[model samples]
Target: MEKVRLGIIGLGAEGGMYAGFLTDGKVNNMVLGAICDIDPLKRTMAVEKYPEIPFYEDYIQMMDSGEVDAIVTCVPHYLHPQMGIEALKRGVHALVEKPAGVYTKQVRELNEFASTKPELTFGIFFNQRTNSLYQTLKKLIEDGEIGAIRRTNWMITTWWRPQGYYDQSEWRATWGGEGGGVLVNQAPHQLDLMQWICGMPAKVYSKVKYGYQRDIAVEDEVTAMFEYENGATGVFVTCTHDVLGTDRFEILGDKGKIVVDGSRKLTIKRLARPESEMSSSMSMQDVMKIFMGHSGNDIYTEEVLEFNDAFGIQHISVMENFAANIIDGTPLIAPGSDGIRGVRLANAIHLSSWLGKEIEVPFDEELFLAELNKRIVAENKYPVNA
Candidate 1:
């Protein structure tokens, strides 16, 4: 087996986490060939952790060196599309972090670039897809255990970030650096999960607040209503202000309801069993007992193991998929094209809040881009002088 040589850019929080996986030999069949970070301290820290691997200050120089087969970009939200596009142009597979880009146009460009290079793989890391509970939920839905989901709701408030956390990095909360607050940063996984399970929305109405929790310019609290194409309604509520928070997803269907409260494990209330199997006469108590027995466990471990099995253990599954697609013709888990949905939805929410209107889906990309650029330019006026 030819080991895949991997390079990593942006040694921030999630970057370091991926680096740890590579260095710890948790992921197999991949070598950490090189690492790059603009920060001198981060570069030094990475060198210290993996002495065999070379470090570079400039990612372009690292890419030019021709030392890596794939690049894991854990850079800021705005940089994901550019870096990923550059990697594909260079014939290097790219695995980018979530909320792939700041705007829809950039994502479309990246996807078009990747499409032209069919040999190149491009993947976005929406790691929550690996969670066991989520997998089970998806499976149940797919299996028609919940008949035609009519309504869904997710309250994701567990992403509490303190003032010090945002203060630690100049790019943390600012629009110019990170794009948006909880929606762009922390809630991409949740958004991706929603899209994965419930599919895209046809219409959206949102209310967003910036200083609801902290003094940041981007929204910290959001309540968005979604009308799915199938006439199913959904509500997404997220906040970084809640000190005592909860992450919950509930799907209400004609036949039953599936509720996943991040704290209380997973629960399913089946209104009625399948007619074909009704002869079993398993009472509601028995059904509840069975459901409880099979509910939440440490699914994260399972996700990691699956990632290891599919792609080399050291490689992130999404990145591995990208590499495989390039090298051996595999499919992308979350392609660059699929990456824009969350950010588009987030932007719609922001736009709706700003304009005081219910933003329609399949929004005007040019208009949104211009508005976002204007907001970024305005915010950058008093840039964080880190």
Candidate 2:
């Protein structure tokens, strides 16, 4: 197949954005063949606006209709793996949105299933991974430009949502419907990028606040601390209600520091000497001088690189790479298997918060599912307004 014929499930906000690009041929060698949505209004709009393209209320029918060679699912958090499995059953390629599933159980199942289908191209919409800045950061860290990493922190709270926004959809912020709040929704990009850049943490401890900034049944504020295998530490903080929020990702290593001040630009500071070498020469008297409030400023050098809004470009690049991989047998920048890491990270955080303790990576999946099930059952007492 020289050109990919793509079908989209879920004609909501995100799905519609993709449809616009496909409809207008934003990328090369790809055609938008079909769209699926259960809503009558969305189906009607698709039929009226893009009458040439096929429409289906049922995804199964769309998959079997032979209108598309691949499928991209933009459904609810829980439905991603489900629909992707169905797409695979149809012998079609699949690309799913972020936060692979509501919990690790579903994600593990999805990844295991995809692992059996070696012929199909399974991709994830981890669009942020396509950003050049993140690519540079990954390369720098992988190259040991900053030596051994000591600490990592992210304050990604730029997302702002009001109570009225949650009222618009039944699955906006409910544990049963949306799974969680800021972490699952706005923070997945950052979380995915975090693990992608700094490597996954060995353990996580989180303090989560449910509806602290709004009237919802899920957490809108979160602070999580992480411990790495190499004794490196991390902190992740996010909230959906912060005004003038910041998006700063800073990582410190034995050699220097790197910062991705997403609001403005990305920069790196290179140290003159390896921290191990510098500290080896220091005595207890040097420690006393630093303890007595003495510090030096000429420790490192700074370098700023070109940074730009990665919004639309990264999205298009994911689709482009997915097609390229399907056609030319290229490696994926963000494969479907890679998505499970972010899901596991989110699950570990929610589980840590629920259990009120430090949880290790590869935590008890059954326990996490049970805790989620308990909260899902409590959704009855706090029904969605819609």
Candidate 3:
């Protein structure tokens, strides 16, 4: 194939937005040759706009039509794994959106199933991984530029969704609909990035407020604490209620620290001497003198880390890389297997809050599913439309 043909499933807001990447010339060597949506209006609009592209109401038909070698799944939170499994069974490559699925069981099953198809390319739409700013952070952490991490904190409260937004759809901001609130929907990118740069937390304890601001049943505010394998602790806080929101992520380490603010400004602080070295070298009297403020000791230097813009890399970059992986065997920016960690973390948050305890990562999947099923079985609880 000279160029990889693409099929997009679910032409909702997300699918429609990604479709423009190919049509708008943001992604190269990728052609939107097929589209699928149950909504007749979405199909009609897609067809009217691109008559050259084939349209199908059914995903199976789109996969069988051979109109595309790869399919991008941008449906709701729950249908991702189901649709991905279907596409993989047909030997079609898949690029899935965030959250992977509503729960880890489904996502794990999808991962296991996809593992059987080694030849097919499977990537997740973790577009933030393509961001130059995060790329720099990941490199810094991986290279020990900040030494061993002591604590990580990301107070990302900028995902302010209006009440009218939830009213736009019934299956949103509900357990059975969108499957959790800001944590699953608006915060998945941050959740993924959190674990991506630092590493997955070993245990998580959270306090969540449901319908705090919106007239919905799911959590709109979340404050979670994390325990790492290396004994480091972390905090994650987010809400959709604050208007003067902020996005600040910082990783504190023994040797230094990095801080990224709302303006994408990155600040670095490096220690003049290791805390261990300084403490060990100083006498108790001297340490007490400095501690008592009788003497002063400067231990660190602060400076801004500078880097050039990365040419506006974002969703299109992920898409282009997906195509390259299928065509030239290039590595994916986000592997589909890694998508489950975020879902697991989200589940742990929900579970911990529900039980009022700190839950460990890889928490019992069967238990989580059972708890989810209880909610789904409630009268008019789960959104059938979703």
Identify the candidate with maximal lDDT.
2
Winner on TM-score between 1 and 3 is 3
Ranking by TM-score: 2, 3, 1
The alpha-carbon root-mean-square deviation between model 1 and the true structure, to one decimal in Å, is: 6.6
Q: Give one digit per residue, the lDDT tens place, for model 2 in 1-386.
A: 98899999999889999999888888686789899999999988999889999999999999999999999998888889899898888899999998888787787788899989999999999998888888889999999989899999999888888788889998789887888888888889889999999999999999999979899988899999999999999999999898788899999999999988864577888877888886888678766765775644444677998678546888888999999999998899999998889989998999999999999998998888778878887877443211
Q: Point out the higher-scoring one by TM-score: 1 or 2.
A: 2
lDDT for position 80 in model 2: 93
Evaluated at residue 347, the lDDT of candidate 2 is 89
lDDT of each: 0.76, 0.88, 0.87
lDDT-wise, the better of 1 and 3 is 3
- Tell me each candidate's RMSD, in Å, in order: 6.6, 3.0, 2.8
Residue 62 lDDT, candidate 2, scale 0-100 = 96
Candidate 1 pairs with clashing backbones: 27-313, 27-314, 28-313, 28-314
TM-score for each candidate, following the candidate numbering: 0.85, 0.94, 0.93
lDDT of 1 by residue, 161-200 (tens): 8988788877778777887899898898888889887888
lDDT of 2: 0.88
> What stretches of model 3 exceed 4 Å from their correct place?
282-298, 306-312, 379-386
